[model samples]
Target chain A: MTTRRTRLSPEERRTQLLDLGAHLFATRSVEEISIDVLAEEAGVSRGLLYHYFGNKSDFREAVIRHAVEDLVAQTAPPAEGEPVERLLASLGVYVDYVLANLTLYRSLVRAAAGGTDEVLALYEEGRAALTDRIFREDAQGEILVDTPRTRLVVRGWSAMTEEMVLSWAEDPAGMTREELLGVLALSLPALVELTP
Target chain B: MTTRRTRLSPEERRTQLLDLGAHLFATRSVEEISIDVLAEEAGVSRGLLYHYFGNKSDFREAVIRHAVEDLVAQTAPPAEGEPVERLLASLGVYVDYVLANLTLYRSLVRAAAGGTDEVLALYEEGRAALTDRIFREDAQGEILVDTPRTRLVVRGWSAMTEEMVLSWAEDPAGMTREELLGVLALSLPALVELTP
Candidate 1:
């Protein structure tokens, strides 16, 4: 039997490839996902895969960038709620995303730890976006001076929250999800207040 | 030319090898340091190197373990000061050690991020020792409950302090050492109080 090929626009084809790649990466490590296998799995030619992403490293970076973008979009706070309520809502969304995509999240953490420059850049972009969102919400009506010190505190608190979520993911019985969110939310104002 | 070999106790010889390994690691990446070169540089035979450490990975792990132990010992709090003063003094010593061993510290961070299990074990040992010291000091007079939540807060605070020092090491001018220490010190009590 002959296989019928479906024609698609370039943008649609790229998105398809990215989706397939992300699916594969979510379960297996980047090192284990070969380009040939990805191409075969996507029903595309190896040359087309390279044409879309240049190389395996580039492809992995693109996948990670897409994931980070998704995280930022998914965790963005609603504009109508009180600052504290919005903060909790945002963190709740963040935790849900992490729990839903734990394998992807673990890969992202591993990449941030020792991945390439492109991966690190994408990680920093995601972190900066999150920090900016928190800062905007956390400082809504407070008479706080915005300085490097304040930014440092915000960044530190962000890192702390990430660590807490990561540890919780490793041991779900460590604390209730609500308790984790509560601890993180309370620490934000305390961190801001303690910043010199 | 015949080289003279000095007779020493097993413990003395182990210390000698560890020192030489640490010295070499201080300037070069772990991948670049090989057993042959280490043996040649240390005036020991390759067989003896293997005798002491089963293999290159074992040798590297031993070196890292030695460094962590040194850090724990060097940063141990004095017995005669107030709890706060002792905490500050310990942190100061820890910071000074990192500053003095910046390359080693970076390697330790990299190892913690993506190195082998042995390296990560060594890193965790060091972190646990430091966290235990802080927890013991911070709990000197308080009747706080010892829960997973409290442990999570202490661990999170430890990570924040590390990130602060790593960032400061990258750019010393970003904040005064005193300010960095102050931010970390102040956040400890706040984190403890905020812990649920």
Candidate 2:
């Protein structure tokens, strides 16, 4: 195990460092946690950590980007279920993910809110991926069509899903998991139906 | 008119200054514009501007808060219309307000995204007002009920409306105003209807 940890390839080591940083980021905001703190937490030297991710700002942005990609990748819809079922499954995963990493989710939101262009762009890239997923399936009776109006409504619905999920995830006691899933599932078809 | 400008009451003068600040903010981001520029634009001395709003941070927050209040107050729904009509009416005003103050609107959004608590809170205050307005009407055959499910859905809808409107407003040529208004008016009912 010691040899394995010491002999990780550059890419593997970088990912390991980012994973450590992401874990630290889960409990602390990006701004509050510094590169030195991350190095100390990961049991690596400052020079080594900086070498993996350039400067302080670059390191923070890289960590945020890593987390965003992880979320997007993790929530990819299931391959077997019906369209709505797949979306619900993805949403369930999303709810659990945010709930487990409450502060990490929060700080990413804060990073986006902080208006750093790179962070904001990363956030948008993640959102656009989710939004595009709603239109990805051309199932036998796909309810949503690709058009300007539907696109706007779905994008708007994405915002709704985000708000509802974040608010519910923050206070899991306040809403049932079933209700959260129901709202997410039902709102999309209903919204697209009313997009005239 | 000159005398009125010079001898305006304290509240009036403060409003006058904030209005000027808001106008300048419409064209420039909050951080990019300074107190000196605001005072110069308003034809007031820097000291007077400082007197009205203490320091740079306070002044920027005050301006943001004032703009929020302005948006809320201006979008008050009509007194004599069907429930849906009233909402559409207010939405029309909201659409216009955001349209005319595009950069100002963008700046406030940036401020919220920037994660300034005061600014974010103000933005929420404005959003809550809009959401509450949906539940405000007890008109005949009101379509929405005040339940936990409904509340969550409406809040989500509010987010949808904001995103759609902002995106639509940014590219008016991409979508017709009628289509924008239609989406806003039609989506609430569709979303609420599906909240179960």
Model 1 lDDT, residue A180, Cα: 86
RMSD of 2: 2.5
Interface RMSD list for the candidates: 1.9, 2.3
What DockQ does candidate 2 have relative to the true complex? 0.61
The residue-level lDDT of candidate 1 at B77 comes to 87
Please state the CAPRI-style docking class of candidate 2. Answer: medium
Question: What shift in Å separates residue B8 of candidate 2 from its native position after superposition?
Answer: 2.2
Q: Which digits, one per residue and each the tens of the lDDT, describe model 1 over residues A60-175? A: 78877778888999998888877777888889999998888888887777667766667778999999988777667656445234567677776677778887788888885468
Top candidate by DockQ:
2
Whole-model lDDT per candidate: 0.78, 0.80
Instruction: Give candidate 2 misplaced runs (Cα > 4 Å).
Output: A1-6, A139-141, A172-174, B1-6, B139-141, B172-174
TM-scores, one per candidate: 0.87, 0.92
> What is the per-residue lDDT of model 2 for residues A93-148, given as tens digits with 9 covering 90 to 100?
99889888888887887678665788889899988877777677634547687877
After superposition, candidate 1 runs with Cα above 4 Å error: A1-8, A40-47, A135-144, B1-7, B40-47, B136-144, B172-174
Q: Per-residue alpha-carbon lDDT of model 2 for B1-196, expressed as tens digits?
A: 3555357889997898888888997668877666888877767799888887889888888888889999999999888877878888888999999889988887787778665677788888888877777787733438687767777777777878888888887655356787678777877777776655
